[model samples]
Target: MENAVLLNAIIENAIDGIITIDDRGLVESINPAACSLFGYTPGEVIGKNISFLMPPPDRTHHDEYIQRYQHTGVPHIIGIGREVKGLRKDGSVFPFMLGVSEVTLSGRKIYAGFIHDLSQQKRAEEQLKDYATHLEEIVDERTFSLQESVEALQNAKEEVSLSLEKEKELSQLKSRFVSMASHEFRTPLSAIQLSASLIDKYAQPFKSEHIAKHVGKIKNAVGNLTTILNDFLSLEKLEAGRVEPSFAPFDLVKLSEEITEEMQMVAKQNQHIIYQHTGKESVVTLDQNLLKNCIFNLIANAIKYSGENTFIEFNTEITGNAITIVVKDNGIGIPEKDQKHLFEPFFRAHNTGSIPGTGLGLNIVARYTHLMNGSVDFKSIVNQGTSFTILFKRHE
Candidate 1:
């Protein structure tokens, strides 16, 4: 008697609604929570058919389902919990999680349903989805703004100068183009990257692998576009005579090691950038920014052109009166015919295939080196390997 009273007390005090139905689908018992949930008292619901508490087709077919379960013994909702619609006495519908179990009591089979309300959770999820949509809208707006800016630049490029000298006009135009592109393109690209990261983070809990993959693709494409824009900006600055090498004294070993570590994160599977500095002297007096750009461009090219599991050899040797930086790769090297025009702006190698690049990387590197009193040289054999060396004469 104590155990029966205890079980009844526990069921009545449970937060989740509980209801029991006879095999014929009549409500045999309803706990206080269940009564409160459906806006019905136990006296009104206990002897009534449970279909009155279900919405639409469920209410119409509830008896059929009970009969089918009794005859066939094939369970659908019997042992499984799933989201379902519930109807209240006020003719309103709501969402809930219903877990139904079968119990045999005194040689009679009855079904017990455990219900947990899901209206609040559903509302929260909808709000989260709305926030994500808002983020996407912001990203789209920024992307459209960047497009308009690019169009404006193109229009400016087509206009003829009125009074200024041709060289000066062209220089000013290039400088404006570089400045506009840098600001316009970078802002949207950064938004895209950030939005993609947030979307990936939000989708993680749902185990949305495909969403994560597409987000990764968006980030990678944004990175590539940013890289191409940087190349164009660098080329424009060089053409407009805006870039000048600022020479400084820095540790070459530390710079090279940092670059190697940073670039390794983006390398292909098993691809390694092996960096080494030779000679006792690790200090060099040169344009640190330009030199770093030159090295980064070469290693990036090596990684792009090389296959997985390949090694990119990056070595810096400080010999007497001279410093040499070499990047060697055993990838698809440039064809002999295309070698001469490799450093030309927008000129991709004939053998480059579908690899994405602006073809301005080498040009920028060459110009940067020339500004710093350095020389760029490369030797390539198609399908075998390529090696690029940047030689700088140490200034006293």
Candidate 2:
């Protein structure tokens, strides 16, 4: 009884299911572990067939298997370990690792079986796999979001860079204006002062040849300073949006003619002026000073670029409701590349070799023309000639 009690204790404490089937394939004994594993009691399963513990098609074929084992004595089914399914008392099926061994003792043939449940292990492995997949998804989403943020930052940086470039350009323009005004103004003012002093001292007779020469020098110096001052003041007014036009009836032909004469006198020895007025003598409402400055700059540029004997053609005409003035010079015309930057402040053409200029004349002309609600156009050839046209609204 002590030995039987010890066996019962071990059977009850065993963690693995143990069972035995007789040669007839009927369950002969089952341990408490088996009872717990398949939800069967010793009393209920002892007299029952072992096929009840097998699921599906295998359950129905168990008797044939046992009959074949008895006749042929095959060891394949009697003592083999494999993965198979089991049927519980509750009619549910689950996976298990089954081990079988044949035994013959006490003149009774039997099969001992061991079973290991696989459900819990399968579930744990699946849970870990799901966790890894979820982590990978989270990482991919974060990477995409980070990329979008970087692109946005790069675009913002590019926009900031472009705005900085524009600010730098405007600042450089201001610096150039200051430098040109100081140097260009002082030299002309000094010449005007020197000429006035010499005339004051040597004017014993009003008809002196030296008096004429000094007087001419003083006049030229004053003219240069006046032109420089006009450009600076006009540009300032334009930038401030305060260039209001003083409209009045004025002679446009006379302004053009006088500017042409002045330009011809300033040109080199070989350059001459040919100016004509084709429009009717009609009065126009405009700012006379602003219009005269524009015309003078245009004509002066024409003569400045031409050879000594080259003739500059100045033509004026009325077309529809607009007045057109064209100035053409047969001199060293501007290159195609330099024409694009013609109106930019302080930008001189690359081909302008040692020409004495502040490079602000065309810029001033463009600003004043825009203020007058007019437009200027030009065409140039390298060594042939250049032509400038201005179109203004006609009014009286």
Candidate 3:
């Protein structure tokens, strides 16, 4: 009696739908879960054919299948489980898993069925598939955009290469033109300088200070033109990449002394250039011609910018692995605004009012220093003075 009561309680409270049918496929019992699944009451389903709860073709063949199983001892859904369709009282169709088992009670055969609803599980699976499809679409769009950006960058690189090539060709043409023009102008300039010197020599006999004065002006003008032409020629060679440094062992002290003597001859009245040397080891390996040109440019600038009777200091120092040369002058120094561009080609300081200059000197110096693996730097305060320093690694 206790076992019967427990079994009845489990079946009545079971979560899955449960049903019992006779051998003729007539419903004998139905649980509350089964009633809820089929939208029917126990009074409506009990004593009716179980086929009424199954949809369509299954409803028609259900009774025949049960008779075949009873006579032939063959089992279709009996003792087996499969997914099948069910019908509700409202004519709605749904899917479920059904398992059937056969039992004998009081000389009569009965079949029990268990139904588990599959609607919620099927819906969740479908939603996962849709989300996967959406992710694939987003990945494809981002890949296409990345490909387009790479192609655009490639196009920009090609354009820059073409522009650089054109710029190189233009620079070559300019260099050639300047070279030709400098050569052409020098001949006439030389003739004018010679004639002016002769006129001054001849007028000295007449003792006429007026003719001497005018001749001096002519000589100075011719000299300035010659200097400008030389600057242009030097710049042309440098831009054309023709100026190569030829390194050799040379005496730094001797070179500095010779340069000082040569430049001192051209200094303004009462202006002096003081030369000094540090460290007894004066020999260094460098391109002598290039070094001379760099030093010459700096001292010339000092002489030109400084007031008459001022002193220009030229110093050279030799230490372990380093060689330094400094040229400082008390001259009309560069302004703060113009100092940043001092080494750029054709850049003149704003403080240079009425002072004649081609503005290529410091630029040439900087390039020459770089060719020899050296560096050049300067400091200047307006109306006070300017100092330029060049340093190189001493090659032993």
Candidate 4:
């Protein structure tokens, strides 16, 4: 009685579905779990063929398989386990694992089969596959976004670097302007004051030569002031885009001669400007005023920077399509490091010590040359000399 009660309790509480079949493949008994698993009750399933719980093919061949097994005394599914489709009471099919074992009681053989549903495990596998695909897509999107952010940061960095360079240039220009005004203006102003005082002191005798000497000194001071003012005005006009070229045909040789003569008055003591003309053609069509300013600035620089008794060569050459102007001076040549920035506004060489200059001469010359559609190039050696060559295309 106790063994019977234990077996009934074990079958009733088992997690897997359980069923018992006779040798004829007929269902003899089923547990409550089996009834719920197949959507059936114990009374409805008892005395029915076990084939009724399997879908077609398996249901049709089940009886033939049992008969073959009994006649041949061979086991096919009687002691083996496999996965197969099961049909529910509602006629829906699902996957389940079936394990069958043979049992003998009172010289009659029966089979007990255990069934495990695979639906939840299959669903969990599908969910894991879907999550893996979703993760890959998210990673790809983030990688693309990160690349775009890096490119944007690089562009922003370049823009900031350009802005800093421009700010540094402007600050240096301001410093040059302040230094130029104080040093350049003081020299001429002091000379003019001293000359005027001397002229007044020697005025009583009315000595013409002494008075003339003082007058010459005053004139030179006035000329220096005028040159500084002109440099400032030209730079302002150039920066404001207000200086326009007026083109005309002019004799290059005559222009060079006139400028050289004018520059001689301001030349250092015992220094002279030698004018030379070469090539066949002398006339060219260009902006004469702008060209004049360019030539004068070069010659004036040559005169100012050279030592006393040095000769400045002002040479000009004209060809069929081009005109070249050369100004060579025996002066304190520009340092190699300062040559690169020589044409920049307000830039002065480190070697120009105690030289009264606004540092705008070469910058203005470059601007004027550019306006005339010309190019200027120079070669210099420290303590030896400096030579500048300007070339212009002859406009037909």
Candidate 4 deviates by what RMSD? Answer: 34.0
Tens-digit lDDT track for model 3 on 1-396? 999999999999999999998877789999999999999999999999988998999998987897887788775666555889999999999888988888889997788999998877677656654644553454344335433433443343344434545767656655664665566656766776787677667656555555565566656666666666677678778887899999898999999999999999999999999999999799899999999999999999999999898999999999998999999998989899898899976678888877877778999999999999999999898889999999998655
Error of 4 at 94 (Å): 99
TM values, all candidates: 0.73, 0.49, 0.56, 0.49
Q: How would the candidate models be sorted by TM-score, starting from the highest?
A: 1, 3, 4, 2
Tell me the spans in candidate 1 whose CA falls farther than 4 Å from its real position: 1-10, 22-26, 36-40, 48-95, 100-111, 122-169, 182-218, 239-244, 277-281, 307-310, 319-322, 351-354, 393-396
Error in Å for residue 60 of model 3: 99
Instruction: Summing lDDT over every window of 10 consecutive residues in candidate 3, give the lowest-scoring window.
Output: 149-158
| Candidate 2: worst-modelled 10 consecutive residues by lDDT | 149-158
Q: What RMSD value applies to candidate 3?
A: 33.0
In angstroms, the error of model 1 at 29 is 1.6
Residue-level lDDT tens digits of model 2 in 274-374 = 98878675566667887787778877777667778678899988655888878888878899999999988656788778553546678877777777788
Give a tens-digit lDDT track for model 4, residues 1-396.
999999999999998899999888899999998898899999999999999999998999998888998898765675445888889999988888888998899998888999888777767756655644554454345435433433443343344435545755644553464366447655755665675566556554544453455355454545555566567667766876789988888988888888888889778899989999999888888899999988888988898789999999999998887889999998999999999999976677998886756678999999889888899999999999899999987655
**Backbone collisions counted per model:** 0, 4, 0, 0
Instruction: Residues 1-396, candidate 1: write the lDDT tens digits.
Output: 999999999999999999998888899999888887888889999888989999998888888887788789754477656888989989888899999999999998888999998889999877766755665565465546545554454344335233346877767766776787778778877877887888788778866455555566677767777787788788777886789888788999999999999999999999999999999999998889999899999999999999999999999999888999999999999998898899976678988887877778998899899998889999999889899999998756
Q: Is candidate 3 or 4 superior in lDDT? A: 3
Error of 2 at 63 (Å): 99
After TM-score superposition, the amount by which residue 89's alpha carbon in candidate 4 deviates from its true location, in angstroms, is 99
Model 4 residue 373 CA deviation in Å: 0.5
